[model samples]
Target: MGIQTIPGYMTRGIVVNGHGQRFINEDVYPGLVGIEALYRQGMDVWVVLDEEAFEDVPEAERWGLQPPHVAETVAELEKGMGLPEGAAVGGDGAAVFTLGGLATDDEGRVRDRDGGPIAGPYAAGRASSGLHGGGYISGTSLGPGTCFGRRAGCAAAGAQQ
Candidate 1:
């Protein structure tokens, strides 16, 4: 299971890799952060925040984790975390789902490379690419998933009958 971090925590901090190099911009959606972290830093990533940034997070959004490690300096924090001398820091980011999927028609039929619907194998929801293009907005999949999933189901049912 993955621990979900709140947007407030993500946007207010800088994400660094094991080498203490800053990567993605912290202002975008947290999903994008997860993707970039996985691609650029593998699993060795951390979000570094200042005192104000840490305090800005509401207690409820902390996911019941213990208080963050306090340190007088970045080197001190890195030493405590067992990282290299310059490495910066937490919240392990795990991608919940990918953004893109199989191309599908309105009826949820899978689309071929030539842009025609395949004969069988209808896909919907996260299984097929629908609303998302490049970036993701939280909860954006729910509406399209329901509508397209129903269309796919109805189409499949009609074909069966």
Candidate 2:
């Protein structure tokens, strides 16, 4: 099996690390950036979504997933999650730690920091990085792979000529 990058997820809630403190803005950067922040604090992190946020989740999305553990107020969720007293709680969110993969350009061509595409190689799926700018929304993982994979395939075919 390959290493997996478990991204943090939250539709609506406050995210706090094990120390009962927030490290990143939940609304601003909810993707890898937020996950990176949680990693700095410690392995243990929790996203406490209130009832309102839970209700916002679309029915289709909730199909297979188990119901979330919820509380009436942020304070209550914090208590259940073992966060420190008076920990600042914010909006809906959650995070999971996962392995980072290769950086790629818009065309699905692997590239260096300087933006030069690497020769004879491409990457898509979880290994690609060009699709999501900041926060990766739910239901985006497969879409990017399918879209960029097509581009990468075309680019590869052209390069062989």
lDDT of 2 by residue, 17-69 (tens): 76566545554434554445545654566665555666676656655454344
- lDDT (tens digit, per residue) of candidate 1 on 10-84: 667766666666666665556676667666577566666778887878888776644345778878878765567
C-alpha TM-score for every candidate = 0.48, 0.41
lDDT of the candidates, in the order given: 0.69, 0.59
> How many clashing pairs in candidate 2?
12
Clashing pairs for model 1 are none
RMSD of each: 13.4, 12.3
* lDDT of prediction 2: 0.59
- lDDT value for model 1: 0.69
* Candidate 2 ranges with C-alpha deviation above 4 Å: 1-11, 27-38, 66-68, 89-161
